[model samples]
Target: MSRARRTLSATVTLALACTTLTGCFDESSPHDAVRDFLVGWQSEDYDLAAGRTDGERAAVRKALANAKLELDAASFRFKIKSVSIDGDESRADFSAEVDLGENNPLWVFDSVLPLHLVDGRWKVRWSPSVLHPQLKEGQRFAVDTKPTRRQPVVDRNGASLQRPQFLYVAGVIPSQLGDKDEEVVRRLSAITGFAQDRLLSRIRSSPPSKFVELATFGRTRYLAMKPKLDTISEITTQRQEQLFAPDAPMEIVGKVSALTPETEQKLGGPQRAGDSVGQSGLQQAYQDYLTGSTRTRVITLDLRTGKESALLQEWPGRENLSVKTTIDRAIQAAAESAVDQAEVSALVAVDRSNGEIRAVAAKGLDEEDDGLAGKYPAGTTFSIVASDALIKAGVKPTQRLACPAERTVGGARFAEAGQVGGPSPTFQENFAKGCVTALASLARRVDAAALAKSAKAFGIGQSWQLPLQSFSGSLPKLDSDADKAKAISGQTVQVSPLSMALVAAAVASGTWRPPVLVTEPSSPDPTAEIVPEPPPQPVALDPKVRTALTAMMRAGAVGTPAQTGSGRVYGVAAPAGDEGSRQAWFVGWQGDVAIAVLARNHDPAAVAGDFFATLHDPS
Candidate 1:
């Protein structure tokens, strides 16, 4: 369901119904630690709230003394009535009243303030710091709160794609901020649309040391409301201040929080923020690389005067680390742009010499599509498995084979879409022509088990380990006579275009090497890093069988100009009538470079036309 369609009214209703009968217990304190936290905050004493953890107390005291340099000057008083403690976690109920000496008072409740235990004492958590000049008002700011950390994201090229620097959330303080608190509540309500009592309650009960609550875009609606910041008395802006490497794919990768509702709920929502999660693309895949460390900074504030008691501060946080990858930015962009026009297609390219991946993409699948890993039936292109089976069964490429109209098996008839179905043609001719019936007839002579084995050896149904996101296309096992028959005809199993390309790549390389998307190490340990190995030193296929298949692929690309011009076109093969001829493929090799192009939603002729166009103009 779309996020906009969700109604937060239900959640608000539940919270209100429970709190109404309790007489605002939301303003009550549940423990001494909670009380201490509030008292320290009210006094702007972070050290006391922090339980004087080593020097955090001293740092906070120092920051408090230099209030003009550290906090906003205007004071906003908060009244707290109660608190709830769950293990090391806690929440304080409060209402706030802001006074700037002008305008009406600003009041709010219903604001949930998060608190945590530090060195055995409860303290305010995830707070937003006010900006300068406003902070110029020494001894005016009353509330105390700390800042939250934002996660960073990077591209495959180790470029700094996304990072958190600093932002400003602002508004003018209202006077009568205490008497006209209700009217002020209504204005804040207009900006936030939160319930009046809730807004009022938040302002009334906030810790005296707290200034402002740190806010983020919670949902699509919140993001949409961003444009109207000018209309609202309070306005905020997020800005970036750094640059990094160019991106590999079309989209950004480090969206780690991209989780489902069930998962998010299990993780305690924003209360116990799990590290930023891979929400989509490479970010979702190599989340570890993009994930860095979080830091904490502590300052000192006065205990009774509610001012900065010191002038220095220290914080505890982690340093950043860099990661390197093996994607070609230019190639990734080219592939992404080419496939963007398709409804449902995927493209993956790997370096042949080393197993480093250059690019990976999906056409038609939206950025959030995870179903790509599942199965989809492969059409006639599956015949490659049958052809390999035929050659293994002693059939020669030059040997004549008959192309028939139909072949019945298990009471089902399979038809061929060849040019001349009445007569016979050479094995090479049949393959070039995609004489499905003939290939099936020849495949019948081979053991079904052996054919399935060959398919497996060719990486069919094998899980591809791309560094970013990927689909582990599959092929179910042949368990029965019906399944075995369907397998030979490419009907019983489903496969992804990525898997098909790997199959072509394996044949071109003379052996199987699982396709990879991450970078390959120099003189790397063959057993440590989890990646596909290079094709074996010697070819897996017998010399004779390999020769026959090579000749057939070459013949398949003959007499077609579109299939002939890309990369010298030394080796070519066209598989026609696959998926209602909606997908036309050209697989070939030019010395060390091997490429495969699969086209969707086009006639064989049109598919072939576009296939060569991309090959010749892969710029």
Candidate 2:
């Protein structure tokens, strides 16, 4: 052959070889098709995935719709593990890591997808099982969560804090009310004492198909007005348990109710509608311990039979545990009775020997835990720290001091109710008389750091790691002479009743012991041993200072009209002229108990004496 014929033949052969190789590489394999389909499905591209399936595209779309509804707000991620193919058939194995919620365990499962040849290309075989095995047509994935029973709160004496009580829940179904929604709400408000406008607004904002709660009432109160409530249309009532506390010192033990939107977000999980959760106080603080664990299971629901079958993953909930607190019933009752006469009053008593909080009582207060965390100007009650600082600074109790009518510090004047004209009174006598001028005059004598250090020795202005929230009081930095005077005289310092009581306890015991509320576990676990927290480092005081302080307080308690024979009560009232409101504070120690009483619009000495008198004679 000639050179030109050979060149043409070689070029045509090379072109055919390149075309054949391109066709072999471009043709879709069963394994590649299955992998691509899985990628689309995992990415939630249901439209793309359904198109990659066989003639059952409608079925695939339906299954995807059901899955979207079941998953709801949950987030999930998928991974294609391996794809195996043999001729016209293929199998794609995959796994999904689903996030149910914070309270629920993460759900991880593996599934397989079956693919077959359709015409000339491979396509996935659509079925509910492709999402999860054991799921059939019309069946969907659902999570069934069963929460454990709520445990009870008990006192130190093992008495149940909660009592069984009946309550009526009133609500309205907006759809059933139709056009009479406003009228029905007005009638319900009239019968139940709920706000008419608020109830109407709630009904309007709620979905027409949902029931909006109006109010809750005691069973007896609801029953007496049942006839009047019945006259309103679309009104509904449901009876349920409402926990009550007849013997509790305060209303901080807490209550439970159906989860609200706010609570649900704060405490995330697979919580269904109507799940009860703690709403306040100790119940809210120890919700996880009180409510225990929740049983979560992924189930395949049969739409036709209304039955459910578990899909391999199941978790059993643990039992709830009770919470035990250190509270003496007798002391709590006495404390409650002591402040019953005042509109706003609080009292705290601690065992001087062990620092165990025995009682905490308050009335007409809005804050939690008997207002132990409430802040107020220390007033003359803070004189305890002033006395300590003075004694530590070598000021003798017998040292004669002038009790002036008024003294000025840091551009603020300090005065007392009854100031002596002469200057013959001793330091002990001046403190007993609640002489703010005398204490203010000596503010420049002691170092500011030394005074603050002395105050912290009594557990004031110290950070504590406690199971429950509390305020130990705070002492601001005294940078000026006037600030020091105000702090020493209790005019600028703030304190809680608990901190004041602890001051008295420390004075009585000569050492500060951190207070403890929980002595033993409410729910004992045989397998788990309870570990006791180490005691706080002791803050020791000079025995001479404690003795002198005790003697001074006793002397101050003398001649008071409300003084009782059981114990001496030393206290002072905040000057009414300086501040708009008057607060009386009394702190004393008797036998092994140290007590502090704070009353608004009442005499602290009188209230303290009355409380001691009641303790002496329970008849």
Candidate 3:
């Protein structure tokens, strides 16, 4: 869009028969002077062009330089179209193309270069017409940008995710402050925790009758501080509602703030003082598509009047293009509500059929999007992958394994199996009971390499297609028996809640596909259309391993806290590592949706049960 090309038909080459000592057409020939004038003008060497012209040198230079700045040109090229001679005068026609970037199509046209004879030498008799056919003596080129309507980010169903939320806005009308303005501002700052000088400055610069907002607070917080705020005579308060994104912890919905010097560069063109722009999450990632392009008009301004005089060309921007996402708003709210009691928690749900994400809910101290990226030892959850590794090595799911309060394997001690399962618990029985000892012992049935390979097959540590800070599961090198034991017990192994969700998805769908959050965006430049992302690569699970793992988890859930999930759910609860207090976790799937939950200071099994039960009712 910022480049230009010379039209081949407009190119004119004159091979004059006459030659001077300069080895070109003779200087006296009108064609020679026209050729020299064209070269100098095209190169923007106004001095040389004026030398071959009868125009004022400074005026010619200023006009040529002004055109480049007015167009904000990236590149401008000129080509000689034709030349003719009549007596001592001549006429030279040329094509000019100026590239105005970010605006579709180049500014291209043809204008005449008037020539005359001065003594025996041919010279161009330049005038305002030489620059443009319609340009007047005191006219200049100007560009007008009209921004198109910004589009909202919507879910797959095109449902608006934004809802109205009210806040308390505290301010004062500058005219009412008068001599007490500084005193009033100081008192307001003390109550509101805002800078006194900053508040005073805002009030002074604002219109005398206008309300100068100094601070804002949530409803509850404002109510608590209202008593103190009332002490200031000039203080005022107003409740106003603004559109806010859905109240979910994942931040996938994003937030917006006004344009600032720091953020102005984020937009493509000159920014206004208060332009809205995305600051984080999907909103920031897809800002260009959401904001769209601006309509551009190339016009002329009467230099003397400093006002628009004529229209040259106009191009409209693509508008009303929505940025689509895979988030299910209802599901997200439900997920967040289910884990509301935890001090810190993360829960992610995915569609079992495809990798499209359904929800990414986290709360409290899980600021790092723990659901998407907080890496923690997965506890007994890694058993899914470890089980697959052993199963491939020919270990039976029903093989009886000892579940004791404490056990040791490969020189590493393991505990935390609170109680034994039944009279004779099998490997599956121990697994459901959150048996760290029994599972760690199984590390002997297969080599360490099988664990890594099985982990890969489950999409753990694979490439995640999301444009976010996320972690795929990672297994430590099993260089020693102690490493294998810890890895097998799910301690010393770190994985995110998202990693567990995909693992559950693999079990449910039998093929693990990378997760997707956003779709392709429409671009302003037609030829600059963005390349569509490659479809997620699917890692097919082994039929034997999948069948064994599914059965093992369903039967195993019978002896653990997660055993409460309405009998219809198939998942497993695992104990995460903590020195003083342990976190809770449930990683598995039910029906067509796979889920993973990790909660601090709460029961993982109970959280999972509550989540599924709520999904069933959703009331």
Candidate 4:
């Protein structure tokens, strides 16, 4: 039986009761009894309604209570349409409206509630039909659902990206569980919503080698629950890998996880369990467009006969529509193949012209998005900003700068990059070669305010209208000379791969616009809110600075690893650390596409090289 929320009043007045019925003389009229009974039933006060009914009051109360669950009702209302009275017997014709769950149509019908006068009072003679006209004795209402087929999330060319993700069992190796068995059991029961006794029994009868499966989850669900299970040593879980490339693109394309109850309630009402649902990425962002349409059948089941006796209502499910994205299939495939197998690496490619993010791929699903929002020192990538500042200040790309092994500016020495000097290399050449000390020396040319202003112009410390979560480059007030030096060279700066990709796009294209992952959010008219009608234009860079920066990057990529064989791609690759052990970079594009490959602990130049190589090659 469903829990009655006490939403309706239990009392009824003689005037109101007599209006619908023909004969009623006073408050003691039998019409008042029928009124009270109908009011109680409509309000879901089962006990109050049952008391005014005759013939096995408890059984009648139960049938009334069971109506909500049997019909999966969101709402139930009863109205007295008309009544006929004959001596001691009366027939109350009422309108019954049983509302099924969300997306399904309402079930409406007319039924007669029988009543009789006894000892100067009237009572509703309750029967199964009193609850629902079709429901007979020992029959209940039931619902049947046809699972929605998920449509594939596609790329710019309409290539499918949706695929089956692995299911993981979150359980314990019986022997390895040891002393924490009780703790594991309790936690698993809570996580899985399984009964405690049933789960405890299963835990007790499991083999050591065979993992005692407690609960199975899709990749998205398992990853979400992994943190909660970390402290429990006995709770063992196998890694959930994607069938493609060790894993499907999660932080970008998104993944399907178990349909959670909390999410279900928000989606309208409780839905059937064990269905894979979009947990994040485009799958979640465009949930309404992807799998919102559903088919539902509402019927009255003959509980004693164990068969559906009548069809109360039917709502047809429509085919799920596909979600077209900004991702390029070729670029996504190439970038996925280029991710470093040894370390957590990420790549983000965006259109330089309009800032449409074309591809995002990552290896190792870490807590933070290493590809999109992961924050790290920008390394030599900061040179792009420094170059912007210096070039704007009349510093030419061909101007020869100092060749220093180490520099002590503002009392803080910057010797992190060992030595990057090549026979009086030009400022642009040194900056392109991942120069550290030279950049520190050039920090004297521009003050902290100028640097911050230039960085801001590059979209640092800015908000994105984009849907995905990302970290815009952070540039605090450059307080001291040391701060200026470090910030100029990127030793103390924090940036994400996505933010850097936009930075590269700013340099590649004349202007920098916010990134758009979902190209076609809505069918005919794209979502005005997400896709922004009259889309935010790319912030234009200074013409002179853009020209100088472009040429410098081309010159810098001369013999560097970021240099592609096609030579159509021009970018910079730089690493940073005390002993150069912390290899990091901000590498991107010169053409229509601007890319960023982010990683910590190793230089991702090789990954960047492999990515560009694929783009230039014809399969």
Note the Cα lDDT for every prediction shown.
Answer: 0.47, 0.68, 0.69, 0.68
Question: Stretches of candidate 4 above 4 Å error?
Answer: 1-36, 39-48, 54-66, 74-116, 125-144, 164-251, 258-269, 284-289, 297-320, 341-344, 364-368, 416-423, 447-449, 522-536, 577-581, 599-602
Q: Using TM-score as the measure, which candidate wins?
A: 2
Question: How many Å off is the CA of 471 in candidate 3?
Answer: 2.1
Please give the distance, in angstroms, between residue 115's alpha carbon in candidate 3 and its true position after superposition.
Answer: 3.2
Name the 10 consecutive residues with the lowest summed lDDT in model 2: 1-10
lDDT of 1: 0.47
| Model 4 lDDT per residue over 406-519, tens place | 779888786634444556778887777767777787767777778887888887877765555677778866888778888877888888888888888988887877777776
What ranking emerges by lDDT with the best candidate at the front?
3, 4, 2, 1
Which candidate number would show the highest lDDT if scored against the true structure?
Answer: 3
TM-score per prediction, in order, is 0.58, 0.75, 0.72, 0.72
Model 1 residue 500 lDDT? 56
Candidate 3 lDDT at 197 equals 46
For candidate 3, the lDDT comes to: 0.69
Model 2 misplaced regions, further than 4 Å: 1-27, 30-47, 67-73, 134-142, 165-239, 242-251, 261-270, 300-311, 367-370, 407-413, 419-423, 466-469, 479-482, 517-536, 567-581
Each model's backbone clash number: 70, 0, 1, 0
